[model samples]
Target chain A: MTTPRRRSQQDLSVHKRQVENLQRRLLLKEMLSLGALGMLAGCDLQDGDAVDKVLWTMSRWNDRVQAKLFSRTRLAPTYEASRITRPFPFNAFYPEYDAPDIDGAAFRLQLSGKIDDKRAWTLADLRALPQSGQITRHICIEGWSAIGEWRGVAFRTFLERIGADMTARYVGFKCADKYYSSLDMETAMHPQTLLALDFGADPLPAEYGFPLKLRVPTKLGFKNPKHIAEIFVTNDYPGGYWEDQGYNWFSGV
Target chain B: MPVHPLPIRVFHWLNAFAMTCMATSGWAIYNASPLFGFTFPAWATLGGWLGGAVAWHFAAMWLLAGNGLFYLAYGLASGHFRRRFLPLSPSGIMTDLLAALKFRLPHEAGTYNAVQRLLYILVLLLGVLAVASGLAIWKPVQLWWLSAAFGDFATARYVHFLAMAGIVGFVAVHLILVVLVPRSLLPMLTGRHSSSHEVSS
Candidate 1:
């Protein structure tokens, strides 16, 4: 009995020492991470410059990983009509009052780059195309979500109709509101993606990307460029408004 | 008295650092497109801009998840969960709460009182909820089942926000208690405490 008690005391002491050693190691690691954070803090670099380059590099790496994992066939879930957020909020770089006023009769979607057809498209021409609609959630990067009904031509159909180079790596959009964005060919061809011309049952309202919007349900809200003016397919990267401002270029869901 | 085991101490600090980064960066991200009407000031948040905040948030998210997993595995494998957090009686917890409300510290040195155990368990559960809801929001389409479980994307965001609020509350209480009894931090820092020290029961 005495020998067993002595052995237990020795084992406890050994265990306590091991715990102390681990705690010390952890403390050291904690200090090291703190140092790294302090360095990051000290840099205090502006967006799109210096230290931000590292972050952008990391963002690009993340984009590659996401793109690699992206499945073309997988669709964003559609919601029921009852689930649609009433008064679907108008969100933009500008205020709702500042929504662009584009004339439907005069509005034309310009086409360019790596396409057989270079002719501009009038609103009527787009309306003549087969129409499709979906009620889907718009997930914002800022941590809020809203469901909205978007009605438009399937972007894949439009892309095919225009004789775009299906082999191209990117499909870039220039919006009338100066908010340009681009998508990977895979995302652009996603079945759920649309060239939205209407909101709910009405012709697309001025406050909701009048004339046309890219309704990309598989992406975060900012990636869905509104009030599209021009679309071009290219192998070269076409930077976007927010992407240039340091948001991730591939803001996929 | 037994001190915190090595794995527990390591995971604890790692989680603390990750959670701090997550909360601060999350605030910055939230300010970009606020859920409520108001926004957090730029100075108050860790990241200066929406993009910067997102970078920080993602980086810390990985750390939080990894550390949390390590903690969970260690707790379960070492029987720490059963010994320290379970077998909690409501009567004992109520007594500890009353004592706490009366400004009497109910804990003895190197041992948790019922109230501390319950709060710790609650915070642990909240952390799990935060991570789950975060995943639902982060990958709603890929993790469609999780999103559906939370009702929808908007509901998941709400739950995530609520979990964050709960964690913040726990942190505030924890910090206050640490200030009130600075010695409580020693075992966490050094993995040892004077066994002889005790509070009157």
Candidate 2:
């Protein structure tokens, strides 16, 4: 082959400089691609339904996968007392001040859906049930977690006592704060699932879903509803406040 | 032989699509509870809100994970990884680093240089980590052992973030390299007819 024309030293450096400049524009192109991405997402939202349907379908599939993964034998990790998040975070969509001030004496937990006992239970009645406690992590979908101590009656013990159908598919709560969530039967029957009435040696404070709250260490924090007004057991899927708004229904950890 | 096989091309493009959704939606998720001092800009993020972003993040997660596993299985079954990314060493990387710094490196089709090999290995491992760390975060309670291996639920978040950052950095460099060697893009797209990586120099 004939010899190719060789570049002068100056020409080579200048070519390198040109390459560097091209790389800068390439980064700019990547940013432009990001803009294209935003536009695609925007179209998916405005054009509607078709994409939403696919996403929701996949989400439902994931819920089933999560439900399958959940085990009644495995327990959420427990922490030492010293490791508890001091001044446990009061998290709710509503502000802390707006927390409902229910009359503890008059507050009664209402029961419904496949339960033989339709009568409500007072705070004392719940506390009188077999009480248990745990210092475990409460994971949030927002990507944060905190450890706290909660004491309450085992949900299974209470469920059995109230003659709830152990074979029921879902146990849902309607909270006084207008927040609602549901748990699969397997999770509801997990060893760590509690109907919490106390927080760290004190009676569960009003700010933290007092008189009654569901402490589910295995799932995200939102699945644990506070100031619970009604408990229902059923095979029908009872979607939650956030879950209805697009959060995963299973919300398992 | 095609420099990029059908399986490899499929994996590459699918990863491109999935990573786009994951990164953009992942940013939206990260913006929900920022680990750092600042957050990603809303305009740059994919999902409109936390819930929307989470749905996108999770939906794309399956794609990325499944695509990644497919790629891994293909690479192992085909012996493509050994042929393309082997013989990497610190000394080889150092030489390539010096040459790269001086703009003396050359691009050849169907072959990887030391630096490219190192980066590919790192990014592949990071991909595995991104998935593993995501699982650790997603199932800290159920996958308690996995979570504890990374220290805890919170630490898993950090690990997941680092994997994303590493992959992002790799993509920037990979894109820039593609720009520098535009010819390389065609094969990855259409599996152009060329000598495979097994060819002698």
Candidate 3:
């Protein structure tokens, strides 16, 4: 058999491809090495997205794409009467100055925002509407938690009475102590939400947002803004006191 | 004259430095919360700021891993790895291992012997485990697959914490060994392992 004098075109093409493949692999390795060093040197800085923002973005996208199997009722488990222990760690606006005592004449709920009808309603008016009560856990971001039964007019009913504008996206709770909180429209209208007035069958203590406080079951303790000064319904994402301080406004438990 | 290749020496000590930083910061983070039976006291403060702790730990991790990768790759490509690790036969390895345990070494013993080989391998392997487990705990969702390897999220956190304990133990022993053999420590620092003839041997 005669020895091959020269490589065929096909053989040359195959050899060329192999060389290209090897070159690509080598290039990739070099890039990875450079990338690792780049991280070490703290290069490749970009702006406009913090780590928490990234997490929230991811969470929102995840929620939209993959609906989590959250319990629909949104009710917290109630403990036995005997189990109710000393001083359930109270939170939010307390001890209203305007109305030290239960003065129905003085207490008036003011509501204003994106609405054709913007006005105040009395506690009698709220009580006249359909009411709801549920035992729910008050989860604090500081890592402590408590469970309490809240009784009041359903937020959905209140929203209807106030003629909440269809375009409104957030409900900003203007509180007594200059403390403000905002809730997303979806959470604001959630079935378990309430404009709470009673704690465990007793009238809410002045320290625990007497007369009226927003009871949003799914939120952390901070989001339930107390001693409601006024309720401002807005069509924009309203940044709250906590949100300005780098805490997420939507403190969903 | 060669001074143990600049990157290799730098990477070596840099790894040791980063390892110590991680251990110290990790101790602080662990003491911040009590989970499982690993209860550290409330007073022990290795890092005063949680944010700083997180930043430094992540920064050190990147540096340690990068240096380790480069060193390993360079050594293997340059045939230094084979010279350092691969050539010894099992019989020679066993003999050297026994000699090391007994604090004995014959003439012409290599820079690293059999027991050193095992310990070196373990150190690298444990470093890798530390990084993997750390990532699993740090970003459970980001590196969910890694976390899944050690079971659920909490379990992975526990494992990562335990792995840091392992690293601390290794470092303690490593320091003791260096103190016992000042000659070995000198080479590591000065990048020169003088011949036995130069010593009192």
Candidate 4:
């Protein structure tokens, strides 16, 4: 009797949260669609010949193709420290000055969906996890690429520790910068995928996602989300910020 | 005699359409962070922006690759490449090149001259290089050896760009030749040789 009551209560809150999220997103899309950036990324709006729909369908189809092409044994090349790009470029949807500043002591990584633990983790807890470092290139969707060093917990290990449903279809991230992204299960489980906590020899600078950043060297730069505040594992498709636009969903590089 | 056979004409037109889509969108993508000092003009590009360009580029990639592969298989299996493009010697090419410079080289229907054969072979090789280099840039991690073969990631981009440039040059010369010999377009369009075509090897 108690268990049924508890489930009903949870369901009600979840439904309410969904409605609120929808309203927020509606407002955001409307505001964004008013600008020149909208013209560049205007798939959500009506288009001549429904060109946007065709492109989006093709992008989704490419996602499946890339998934088939991905091999578990394939590893993104690692460079020597000397080859690491000097003055590594900083990239974000917003300008550099607008990068969020959060208090480290108050930070907590919220976890939900398919996670057995369902408990938030602090910076200290994250630091205590087994860690590794890598020097790898970050290939952007545009055209340029950069190499950098990052040290953090392997994402598979982190997911295992959190008791994530390993078979889940997607691992989604909600970033403090209002940026969000999702990954296919295979990519999420890649050995090199990291919940990066440090950049170079320093703790991650706020500008580079001080608390956490998803470092996926095998994917395009936008796939590696920064300033992560929440993580969820789900079977549902979690569309990304750029992905909801015209960019391909599986932007593997 | 058929100058351009039905299957060959089909493949040719399909390749032309696919190449146009890929090249125009690729130019738009190149504009985002151009490897060179300049970018393609807005009018020359297909997509309105980087994201749009990328979507078109990847989508058209399938058409180009599929049509090109079919074309290659058919060309080899039918012995078309052997019959039309064989006996290509450097001296023959030089002879044709010098004659062509004086505007006296013959355009024999149903036969490829040494210079024309050399250009076709070079362009075919460029097509393969462009696709391979494109895959390298698209998936440098999974296709690591491919990019490495070209020297690196950046080198792959360079190779892709050069291959595209070569194909564009070929297209320009091809169009000019068709304009000069207006009768040439008929064979491609109708897949038949109306003139008393020279079918000799």
**Each prediction's DockQ against the real complex:** 0.22, 0.39, 0.03, 0.20
| Model 3: per-residue Cα lDDT at residue B24 | 57
In terms of lDDT, the poorest run of 10 residues in model 1 chain B is: B192-201
* TM-score of every candidate: 0.82, 0.90, 0.49, 0.88
CAPRI grade of model 4: incorrect
lDDT of 2 by residue, B64-143 (tens): 98898889988988999999999898999999888888887766677788988998999999998998898999999788
Per-residue lDDT tens digits of candidate 3, residues B27-103? 65565454556745423333344433333454466667778888889888987677777656678778887776666
Weakest ten-residue segment in model 1 chain A by summed lDDT: A39-48
Residue clash pairs of candidate 1: none
Q: Rank the candidates by TM-score, best first.
A: 2, 4, 1, 3
Give the lowest summed-lDDT range of ten residues in model 4 chain A. A36-45
Off by over 4 Å in 1: A1-54, A96-98, B32-42, B102-110
Ranking under DockQ, best-scoring first? Answer: 2, 1, 4, 3
lDDT per residue for candidate 3 within A131-150, as digits (tens), equals 77877656554333566778
Comparing 1 with 2 on TM-score, the higher-scoring candidate is 2
Which 10-residue window in model 2 chain A sums to the lowest lDDT?
A1-10
Q: Candidate 4: where are CA atoms >4 Å away?
A: A1-48, B197-201
Candidate 2 retains true contacts at a fraction of 0.60
Candidate 1 lDDT at A136 equals: 92
Model 1 lDDT, full chain set = 0.83
